[model samples]
Target chain A: MKLATIRHGATTTAAVAVNGGYLPLPARNLSELLGTPEWKHLVRVATSSHSSPDVIPRTEATLLNPVPAPAKVICCGLNYADHILEMGRDLPEYPTLFAKFADTLTDPDAEITSEHSQSLDWEAELAVIVGTTLRDADEAEAAAAIAGYTVANDVSMRDWQSRTLQWFQGKAFDATTPLGPVMVTPDELDPEAGVQVICTLNGEEVQRGNTMTLVFSCARLLSYISTFTTLRPGDVVLTGTPGGVGMGMVPQRFLRDGDLLRTEIPGIGTLTNTVRIRTRATIQSV
Target chain B: MKLATIRHGATTTAAVAVNGGYLPLPARNLSELLGTPEWKHLVRVATSSHSSPDVIPRTEATLLNPVPAPAKVICCGLNYADHILEMGRDLPEYPTLFAKFADTLTDPDAEITSEHSQSLDWEAELAVIVGTTLRDADEAEAAAAIAGYTVANDVSMRDWQSRTLQWFQGKAFDATTPLGPVMVTPDELDPEAGVQVICTLNGEEVQRGNTMTLVFSCARLLSYISTFTTLRPGDVVLTGTPGGVGMGMVPQRFLRDGDLLRTEIPGIGTLTNTVRIRTRATIQSV
Candidate 1:
């Protein structure tokens, strides 16, 4: 089942993507939909009923990130062994975790602005969306709590990220990170079995890896994360990206003003974002 | 003017602390109050008229963290030179910033439970609350955006914190960090000039420093943070702590099951939380 959030003028609402069209759901957004206890049953009923009331063609409706304002956005760092070796670093024993606020999220097709940084890089990743609230969860509990999976590009600013020991400031630029086209249910998409995740620069393939290559599995990461903080229904865990970031390139290539970044996972979908460098006037005015 | 949030049964609401009493505001919480355009003026109107039809005395009203659910809780790491030196690190060129989710926050007088950690540590910090939204803001703009100042203890689980290179996991435990008794407006509290910040364990003065020693001032940090993400009302920045945490002490002291942790700033009120180690059942049950 594919669930998405589609924008309608001033408001965004959760909708079921069906046969190249969106059947608008009563819920405001995927975050709100997941918070409800009987979301699965509710979505099933909405999916089966013919009276969608307002079905928008997929191409016309603006698709946003499945979970626009998640309660928590926990990102994993150094989870890919290939990426680690490429960067000339040893594989870490534990998953290096970090945080990104909700404001950092942008639409799937939104323009990525290079305002504070010109050295923008792209990292293709598989994202896990939580369905149920879990705390101190075991492996089975973590597995049971899985709602679905999506695609994301952990767009990073190399300069600001390396300005200090922490990677948050650089990685957390507002509306810089592109997420989603839709979320595919876990029954339909199992990243553990090795799904191809790819990134392209202007239709040229740059990054390629299998989700099975992750150092930590989704269940293990979620269980570990739940040890400290409660994983809410709409919380998202971005499994770290594989190799082929701009930083690891031969000449350290970066995204130019008009560069297009396309992030894709076969079972999920694609996110195409155009990089736009903001001028001095536009920088301070935002 | 002082404002607070007080718990009534399971729900909490915004309040004004006046004349040693709490006047329940119409808004849901301090976050909601600050989100309004003219909160200061509205609060003033609520304060002077004496029509606090639902007033609760400060003693009887159970105060929660003033900002119960901020959109973002950005914690600055190693801001003070003394603490940075004590921790065997050089002064950083940029402020070390990390994040804590809203779940990590606990009430000022709530029991500070040591769930998975016996090596609980304390970091006394002055907190800045944002009142308006701003992006790429100047120092003057940053100064104007500050709504107030408060007290917080960045309680840390050292064992988990040092598990990886990043400190997020160890720092963000459910309801671990203590914040707020009340929020003092910036007109009353200026952390730049040097305000006394202290942390005591069972009445033993362990950590002591002044805000004057902070490498990054409030305005500077706000300005720096604005470069990437917009600072919205109800967002909080927990300025990094000063020296003398349990992690920095000789012989390495830690929190016991029944230790009293008190965090205080001169202008802002005190936060006294009793440390209680979570039982085996309580650990997995939450």
Candidate 2:
């Protein structure tokens, strides 16, 4: 099953993707919907009968970030072996972690703009959402708490990122990370078996890797994180991106004023966002 | 004026510290109070007429962490000039920043326990609270937006921190960081002129530094951060600690079970937290 937070006219709602439309759920967004303990049962009941009047046409709805108000949005760095090797680092015994607030997330098709950074880069990743609370969980228990998977582009500002030892300042620019076209349930998609995580820049393929090559799988990462912090329902954990980032190129590459960035996963859908780099002059005028 | 979230029996309320008691505000906590646009006006009106029946005696109230639900909890690393020099690094041109979640916070007098780490350490510092929304703000604007100042101990797990380049995981253990006894408004306690940030272990003093020596002032840090992220009312920013953390000691010290850790800022108040380290055996038994 595919789930989404969609905007229609003046309001947004948690909806289930139907044949050619969306069936509205009870809550305003997926974040609120997941907060309820019986969300799965509610989703089951809502989808049981999607009457003609209850379903909104797909063309009339605009998909938003599925879980926008997560208490935590954690990201793993150097999880992909190929990416680690490219950066000349040894495989890590523990995952390198960082954080971003809910404000950092943007709609699937929104424009990602930044004026403070000149080195804009891209990291296409598969994000996992938590279905249940987890603390000090083992790998098996972590797997059982899986809610679903979505697509995200970890858009970064390299200039600000390189200014300090921590990557948070650069990665946390408001509305930089584009998330969700739809969340695919774990029962339908298995990242462990394999799934291609792909990224394209202005129609040119830049990154392509399989989840099978991840140094830390989704469940393992969740278990490790829960050792110190609690993972509640609606929280997001982004699996690290694969190799072939622009930062690793011969001369390096950055997004221009109007570059189109697309991130996609086979089971999940694609996020189409246009990059808008505001120059200092443009900022001063505003 | 000193503001706090005081617990009376099972409920908590945002209150102002009056003569021998607290005058209750309209909101449940400081976080909620700060969210309203007319909070200052409300505080003014409430304090003007604090009848005996409306005031809760000081002895009857227990103080919890103020600003419990900040959307963002950003922290600075290596901000004090003396601390930076002690670590053999030059003053950074930009502040090194990281993040913590609301769950990382506990009451000022709460017990801080950890079962996953053995290298628990303490960092005493001043914490700044945002009073208004700020985006791309100048230093002057940022300064004017400060709601108040409080005390915090950035408790850390050195073992986990050293496992990766990022400091987030180590600093983000649930309920490890102790924040607040009370919030001292800008007019009352000024960090720029200098405020003594002191820390003691057991009964011996370990660290004492003045905020005047901060490499990045509170206003400067806020201004820099606002360039990339939007900081709203009730958000928190913890300035880095002074020179004498357990990790910076000659023999390298760590907290043990039943150790009393006290963090104090003269005009503000002190946080008395007992450190409880849970061994693997103790965890297994539970």
Candidate 3:
């Protein structure tokens, strides 16, 4: 089963994909929908109902970030063993975690813009959405709490990132991170069994790695995070990107204005965003 | 005028500190009140009213964290020049910033506990609260947007903090950071002229520093942050701690269970929290 936050005309709503259309749920978006304990039952009922009167055709609706209002948007760094080895670092015993605000997330196909930094880069990742409250949860409990998985590009600005020891400033620019075309439930998609996380620049493939090489699995990452902070419904945890980011390229290529970036996780979905870089003088007053 | 989120019996309301009492506002807390553009007008009208029918006597109400639902809680690190020099690092060109969650905050007088970490440390700091929407704002605009000032202790778990390069895990434990007895509006308190930030552990002074020596002032920090992310009303920004944290001591001293920790900024109030560290064997399942 897949879930999405669909924008049809002026209103946006939490919706389930059914019969090649979207069946709107009661809440405003997926984040609010996930907060209720009866969300699954509601979705089940909606899917089984005979009425098709309210279902909107897929083409008429636009998909926004599946979970937009997550209170905590935590991202892990260097979880892929291959990526770690290439960067001359050992597989870390603990995940190097940082945070992003809900303001940082944009719609799946939104235009990504930056004015402060010229070195824009891409990192394709698999993002986990929590469905239940979790604190000090063991691996199994964390696994049971999984809501779904989606695709994201942990878009970064190398100039700002290298300014300080922290990566937050570079990674947290508003609307820079594109998340979700749709979220695929764990029952239908399993990263442990291996799913391809792929990234493309324009029309050319640049990154291709399997989730099997992730040093910290989804459950382990969630459990580790729960030890320090509670994971509530709709909270997002972005697993570190697989190998082959622009920063690691031999010539160090970066996204230029008008460059098209696409992030894909086979079972989940893909996010296609165009990069827009505005220089200081030409920067809009926003 | 001072504002606080006061709990009287089973209910909580945003209240104005009046003639030795609290006059209730319409919102549930300061965060909600600040979001409305007419908060100042509303407070003014409430204060000018002759009748005091709804004012809760000071002793009858308990104060929670004044702004409880800030979407962004960004913190600056190593901002004091003196602390930076003592740490053997030159003055940084940019502030080292990090993010914390709303869950990390607690009532000013709450007991702080750590079950996963043995090295509990305290960082006494002055916190800034945003009163309006700010995006790509200048220093003057950022300064004008200040809602008020408050006292906060960025309580950290040194053990968890040292596990990875990022300080987020250690800094983001739920209900560890104590954030206010009340919020003093900017007109009543000024950090530019210098405000002493003092910390005491078990009634003994351990840290003291003046905010005038800060490398990046509150306005500057907010300005820099607004360049990347939009800071909305009720968002928080901690202006970093001074020298003399437990980790910086010659022979490091950590907080033990039942130790009284106090953080004070003269014009604002003080936060009095009791330290409680639980061992793994005794850790509660919550």
Q: Best-fitting candidate, measured by TM-score? A: 2
Mind giving the per-residue lDDT tens digits that candidate 3 earns over A61-172? 8999999999999999998987887667888988999999898999999999888888889999999999999998999999999999999899998877877778888889
Model 2 lDDT on a 0 to 1 scale: 0.93
TM-score of chain A of 3: 0.97
lDDT per residue as tens, model 3, B77-185: 8898877876668888888889999999999999998888888999999999999999999999999999999999999888788788888888999999999989999
- The residue-by-residue lDDT of candidate 1 on B1-286, one tens digit each, is 7788888666678988877588877788898899889988888888888654567766678878999779899989999999999999999888888999888998999998876777789899999999999798898999999999989999998877887778888899989988998888888888887899999999999989999999989988999898988889999999999999998989898888899999999878899999997654343311
DockQ of each: 0.56, 0.61, 0.59
**Chain B only, TM-score of each candidate:** 0.94, 0.97, 0.96
The RMSD of every model to the true structure, in order and in angstroms, is: 2.8, 2.2, 2.2
Q: Distance from true position, residue A67, model 3, in Å?
A: 0.9
Arranged by lDDT with the best first, the candidates are 2, 3, 1
Q: Which whole-number lDDT from 0 to 100 does residue A114 have in model 1?
A: 76
TM-score, cand. 3 vs. native: 0.97
Tens digits of per-residue lDDT for model 2, B1-286: 9999999988999999998899889999999999999999999999997788998999999999998999899999999998888777889988999999999999999999989788899999899999999999999999999999999999999988878899899999999999999999999998999999999999899999999999899999999899889999999999999999888888999899999999999999999999988775432210
In candidate 1, position A45 carries an lDDT of 83
Give candidate 3's error at residue B71 in angstroms.
0.6
Error of 3 at A283 (Å): 10
